[model samples]
Target: MSFRKTGAAILALVMAASLPVAAFAEEEKTIEPTEVTFWHGMSNTQEQVLTELTDRFNEENEYGITVKLVNQGNYGDLSTKLTASAVADELPDLAQAYNNWLTAYTDKIVPLDEFVENDFDDYEDLVEGYRAECEQLGFIGALPFNKSTYVYFYNKTMFDELGLEAPKTWEDMLAVGEKFMEEKEMPAFGVDDLAGFLEASLAQNECEYASDEGALFDNEAGLETLEYIMGLYNNGYARLIGEDDYFSSVISTQRIGGYIGSSTGVSYITADDFELGVAPLPTNKKAAANQAGTNIVMFAQDENQQAATWEYMKYLTSTEATTEWAMKTGYLPVRVSAFESDEYQSFMADDITATAAYSQVDAFFPAAMFEASNAVRTSVNTMFEEVVLDELEPEDALAEFVQIINEECDVE
Candidate 1:
């Protein structure tokens, strides 16, 4: 053959080699689905919706991957189970983990960058904003699954009856909360606990719960932030509740006017027959919110199971799956595509509270760093609670808060 002809022949042979591999992938897809176990920390009504999604994925995927869904209990319970499993070398193939836990569990989890590269072209299309935060802590470690942001869950009917607008600022919140209590005979807002709420709001107000460098916690923002919670408690606007209970009970029963909770709290609202309104957590002049909810993390597994697990993980956060999960369970969809889908748009249209929650996602900052950074926050909560029950002076409690955080949350 002539030199040109020989070169063309070589190119054709290379193309033929690639085509066979592509054809094999298509043909091999007909084989039995791989089995994957997904251990999660959702319960009650949320568990039902979660199972439905896993069933849907099983029903829809051509790639033979069967997902065995397991509820490992709530956050604390799940974390303990995961830790024990890790030590025993028996962690689930895939798991749902809090963003904070990512740091502690990074060793056992696979970084998802390779999976994103192979499975999806635009990883950013899968999730945004907080992707940087996720990556910062080791991006490859997990996929954001049931993510949420703090939103003010309010009683819309009461607001209308009283001609009250959604409170925008802390000052406005205080004024409205006081008026609601005095005139409407309601506590203004109910909180399950103040630590998480106060940390998020203070972060929004440019308060550093821990330093930006992740080195220290006792800053002006941190102290002022605690004082703000003290202000709320002192004024009787926010009734502190326990972590084990749902504040929706307080809202539905009309025991409280509203509550500041996660966008994910909608699942709890389903059990109660009440009109709930959702709004972004009341902001400072500069609006900010800390992201909440869990991520789908992978544990150490064999290569075959890892590949299969990635497939299921990809499905969970896909436009269809995330939309289904968000609509049914009230967790905000992590993917931007999920928000634009007709399913998400229609759901938001039907519910004003959903619309409000959706609108605030842009202002959210993922609370991933706080799991390790905010040990002092718990101390602050205890001090704030004392102030709430009139057991301590606000300034005195705050001074103690500064001391505690300095010792605990400080990186030194």
Candidate 2:
């Protein structure tokens, strides 16, 4: 080492030794100027809002953190890239993540407990369901980004004219469809996600979904869930997106009574000549609905990088930012305060679709995150297709499903 540098280091150490330990300990913490790279898969209006938020943070943050966004296609493309980057230790500082992907790379993720508690002022305002879902590996490893839940969107005018109310149970749904059968001369009920229908229906019927052991939805409740879904399709009462690629297509044609879809479906739907209304999914054994969308996760990095990345994470989830995001995008706000804010209150007053789904946020449930979670989700979709579209017996399809998932998700 250079003599001058060595002498300077020694002198600095001597100076530090002269200060009282208590005084040094009391010094305030500070952040170094940092450039945080964020990876995400948001597109369209979602992408525009994300950029606006990032630009605002870059311009307004006191910590001198410059956040550069890396837009990585859609969620599927993002997941494929993340799988490769994680193994190579080349992950961006932070990225949007699914719990399954986060589970797959738990060792590489940085827990956010410290930041959630110490740096965030609105920690207590976060919705409990999303907060609970973020607790991974016994610590907060991710934060809800663009959350949504299944909601029943109905043509209020037609429902009222037919003397039908928003269904309160599976029985109510089947009974109400009869009225639509008389008028529409077509299937009036639909669900956008059959896999979601299976999972959420199973949970509602008091059946466990899956776990480290194996697939759990092979019991009576599981059979009943499949039978219910099959009956809807076979009876010409309901359809799925897979069946016809329909939802907005049907709604735009004014041929739908109602459908179950993510709250974000509000963006694509218009009631046309009918008055639109949204309501929580009808319940059976429980009022459970499956939550959708992803969260933001940070990778393990140097202390400065971690701190700066965390700061941005905290900002992204703050009440003001989340409220503004929900107003601009169709996503549900993650914070209760954000939803309660006067601006959002006014927004929802006009946007009844959002208001209805927000009422069921407490009922939202997350799927299990395991090594083979993504694969199992695909299998569930296949199971639905086999039973509903291909006319496979529910029990036989379920048996094959259990075997495949047990082999794939059997964790060590």
Best by lDDT: 2
lDDT of 2 by residue, 163-245 (tens): 88998888888777766887766666887876677778888898887877878887899888767766677677886565456
**Which candidate number would show the highest TM-score if scored against the true structure?**
2
User: Cα RMSDs of all predictions?
Assistant: 6.1, 3.8
Q: What's the lDDT of the predicted structure labeled candidate 2?
A: 0.82
Note the clash tally of each candidate: 7, 0
Give the Cα lDDT of each candidate: 0.73, 0.82
Candidate 2 regions off by >4 Å?
A: 1-27, 242-246, 392-404, 410-412
Task: State the lDDT at 304 in candidate 2.
Answer: 86
Q: Judge candidate 1 against the unseen true structure and give its global Cα lDDT, from 0 to 1.
A: 0.73
* lDDT over C-alpha atoms for residue 205 of model 2: 90
